[model samples]
Target chain A: MTSTSTAAVHALAALPQPYLLFLGDTTEAGFAKTAIGLHDWAPEVCVAEWSLPGCPISTGLPTMTPAQARAAGARAMVIGVANGGGVISATWLPALVEALEQGLDLVSGMHQQLGDIPELAAAAERSGRQLINVRVPPRGIPVGNGRKRSGKRVLTVGTDCALGKKYTALALARGLRGIGVDADFRASGQTGILIAGSGIPMDAVVADFSAGAAELLSPDAAEDHWDVIEGQGSLFHPAYAGVSLGLLHGSQPDVFVVCHQPGRQHVLGYPDYPLPSIEDVIDLTVRLGRRTNPAIRCVGVSLNTHGMTEQDAQAACAEISARLGLPTADPMRQDGRFNRLLEACIA
Target chain B: MTSTSTAAVHALAALPQPYLLFLGDTTEAGFAKTAIGLHDWAPEVCVAEWSLPGCPISTGLPTMTPAQARAAGARAMVIGVANGGGVISATWLPALVEALEQGLDLVSGMHQQLGDIPELAAAAERSGRQLINVRVPPRGIPVGNGRKRSGKRVLTVGTDCALGKKYTALALARGLRGIGVDADFRASGQTGILIAGSGIPMDAVVADFSAGAAELLSPDAAEDHWDVIEGQGSLFHPAYAGVSLGLLHGSQPDVFVVCHQPGRQHVLGYPDYPLPSIEDVIDLTVRLGRRTNPAIRCVGVSLNTHGMTEQDAQAACAEISARLGLPTADPMRQDGRFNRLLEACIA
Candidate 1:
């Protein structure tokens, strides 16, 4: 047994890959982002998609059940839909149990353990298959010591949770390397961890060590090297500001990009709490962030403009850039949209 | 085993008592704050103190070994010393094992587990005494929903960890009740939990659920009733700011008291990281706090002037009160000093 004083970061990297993605009955594309993310970022390891009948969402991967996917070289079935509060639905149990029985290890990012369900546990035990909870942080993560590290970091913070922080950071890292800069994408959540083959599941870590874990996520490196760290919950997100604050302080980003969903009004799941403005996010990020990183600055703004017209998305980005005096881009735009942001970050 | 999605708050309240306090071999009084706090606040439960040879600290209770304490009717031995970062010393293990062997249940607030050590676990098992870890939060705590509860809450925030957050909250709650006010002291750490007979172990909570657990701590009280919540960790502290921010947002305190140690230059564990100014702390607390409670305001300052001369402490309080335009008082001062602070909280 390991010392309880330390925590281990067991990543999805060790899970037998070539995965069959379980999308549950989620019809919304947003709920299927994890499966889509894997298809987009780690396509080679994603064998196919599995969803219940009537589920209209798709990652464009071939539809296959657990038995078919396992026969097609899939060794683990990943629960790709992030049900709200990470609570597993009982209806999703049959597919999960089937995956285990079919000789595919059942993996989940849910806070509610997949093995805790009697049927799933029984199936796994009988089949000798594994049940992995990526959201359960391993023991013994030390408390963060607010020491300045040598390497530079850029974190993608947001006005709320899940608005493109992961996508923006992924794009920025890829874009940085494209421009001959030394950069690495640092994932902070389940989907990102699965995509990157490694990362700290920030939301699952013990609260006291959030910063410490972040410190470990992007350790000391060449002064010129950049760790493009993906951010989690927003500074104004009432339910998650604490997690956001800890990540902010721990990441100590030399540069930050604010991620926002233009039409999103209230914090996700918290209808009573309205989302903070981008300006407010920037102001508070700098105000509290100065405790750990006095030189931290916002290099750009990243908007998730998936539902908007091209003209409207461009207008929003242009208007925000003028108002906030920072470069703005929709990370999905493949043109030179991030050039200004890249320049500012490297500067 | 419990559902992993939710967390439980098991307080030190049920530990078999009147107790024997274990002081370890700590030389500093600050390190012995737990033992002293129990002796000071929960005197009825604390019958004696135990420390190894050469330990200079004292809780002013009669010294007793575990055997002697058990003979004197003590049913539990409490680890009352907060060793830096709660790392237990190997030298203290023998005394702990002795306590378990001498017909006493062993309890610890340290992040390190007593049962994890073979000697103590064997002793407890052989003797049929329990090994209780108040630091281990129970299963099935939901994520914070950021819901507004019906209650007037006051939180004692800090400039760093291990100052006066717990004591100040205790005093304010006691003083509020003395003035015919409906109030309760809500503990957030182990010693505070022991003192109050219940609390959420903020440090042990999963990072994502810190705020959610805290919401459960204060709960919904009468609109006029006050939940004087004990704070943990400073927002400026490197190792524990996440815990602090989570508690702050969860408590949603309408009024907060800033607690500081007059001469503390650095964060408790990290000497390289300096403690934040009271002004800086107040600014950030209110700024971040506004997200949870729009009318959040600072009511007063709680200073730990234990190492200061009476004249120095008085002068410091006067200077700070005038500078910040907030009432200031040393919690140890019983000259009706907290009256002004209490009035401001209710105001």
Candidate 2:
């Protein structure tokens, strides 16, 4: 996702909760992931959901209008839809302006700044509300220097985008903490930022400073602490490998987990190329990851078998583990199936 | 180099030529590559050079002030110094504002926008002159798709930054044209953009669009035509590797030339990380490059031996060529030494 914000994420982190989620008029469940993620992960901060007519998807939160949300104590309205191109839709502007008019701050993670639109800017000014763009990175990010930092890191890498990298990282970080390990799940995408309340949107950063931003995201900590970084695009992805490589170099993860989806045939949008083999991903990750951290290795494989039956998922995980000689599990599997992956990471 | 521009490169390509070169007060020859490059490669468009007093370097062009250069038929003043941080120095503001007041359009390739400075903006407006920041990328860049374009491409990959990747690409493209071949030099950095007239500042593009920009830089062409692409950053670089990898995948070169400086032991600005062996670069580049172009190969090696004597340089090239069993030459050497490397590329 493209994000461009000059606003500090500290302000974003404290966005007056609970929020009114705005789902733009997109029927694609993929585009409404923000609302679903917030509802699933940060329910405490979500008051209700709002969408234009015929959007056909919901976060299952109570439906409300801007005025009703204001009365319901939502201090802010979060744009809960990620446009395919990271743009603010002209059709959705009327609803956004109403949210600002109703005494609520407007928050977005799109690359386009909200203040650039005259109507939104005027309404925000008239209502004395803030327009927060969390995607814009703060200035003065240094170029990455390749200096090693203290603390261990575990980055979740994938063969493609939206293939369980973020979910695996979140599960790993939470599981690490559950096992008495000091850990933090570092977010790198817009939806992850909204859920965690702070993150550097890696894809939106200037090309020159992406690695630097990754370094800033997970700074120095205790030697035993772990920063489980939410990965962006895969190392093999044609469009986003730059962000992926920069983050890999800067995070300097001592170990990483390879996250993949079974039964996928090609990169998300590019049909000319087929998906790379899991072995190829592992080989490239290790060779390239060695640049920043020589000890880097793949600790496990996290499969996203959302489409498969329980029996098929178990068989796939076992086959992959035996083939790669690494721990394997579906972190999102309903029956606490992340135990082996978590153990491999800490081991 | 970092550049952000909303203006189209078509406008930048037609920047009023017959220019005055502005050499900011820097004793470092490296930072003055912009002036040196334009003076050497595009001298017909250069009228004179200007530098703050006490600066130790010169492009050997006659010295002149903004007014004097304007009187000499210079239509624009090019900021000929590249700041290491891609920032505009406050100390250089007076000279820049004076250029605008003197009726010469001011042009810069710095990441900081020229119109963002109040004094420069006011002076340009009052004088009816334009302030051009070529570093800024125009909006609407798409994500890379890794589709094969109908052209043969030769990209100059480097072992480290500032190791003659641009020079090698420029020389190779020129040589190809000399032999009755259809070839175009594609620039991906500020200096190269200034020289080539129209090209993307790859380092300045948003991380998400950089690969897409690269794909745009070398689009479909005649089957036998060659696009000699100037690369940015090294795969070993901590900060800019993302830009490098994206460009590599997008360029999808059929053959690549590895450029290196003979004695450099570490990355230019990063002192802690040792440079990877040339063999390692080839191995990783081919392994990763095959994802986009399965036929990719390292054609030759280009060394920057400006610091060495002719005899020493020849010895170094010969030694490396013998060691790797690949053709090696100093493309910038006297007496047409790039012949072997050039032959390798097209053969």
Per-model lDDT: 0.84, 0.85
CA error at residue A100 for candidate 1, angstroms: 7.7
TM-score of 1: 0.85
Spell out the clash pairs found in candidate 2: A3-A135, A4-A135, A4-A136, A5-A135, A5-A136, B3-B135, B4-B135, B4-B136, B5-B136, B5-B137
Worst 10 residues of 2 chain B by lDDT: B1-10
lDDT of 2: 0.85
How high is the lDDT of residue A164 in model 2?
89
**Against the hidden reference, what TM-scores do the models get?**
0.85, 0.91
Per-residue accuracy of model 1 over B1-347 as CA lDDT, tens digit each:
11111123354235567889998888899888778888888898888999999998898999998889999999889888886667778998888888888899877777777767777777877888787777777556668878889989999999888888889999999889989999999888888877776777888888888888888888888988999999998888876888888888888989899999898898887888888899988998998888789999998999999979999999988999999999999978955556888888898
Per-residue accuracy of model 2 over A31-71 as CA lDDT, tens digit each: 88888888887898899999999889988999999899899
Candidate 1 per-residue lDDT, tens place, A99-212, comes to: 888999877767677666778777877888877766666555667878899989999999998789999999999889999999988888878877775678898788888999
Candidate 1, backbone clash total: 13
Q: Write one digit per residue (lDDT tens) for candidate 2, span B143-261.
A: 88788889899999999999899988988898888888899999888778777766788887889987898898898999999999998999889899999999999999999999999
The DockQ-derived docking category for candidate 2 is high
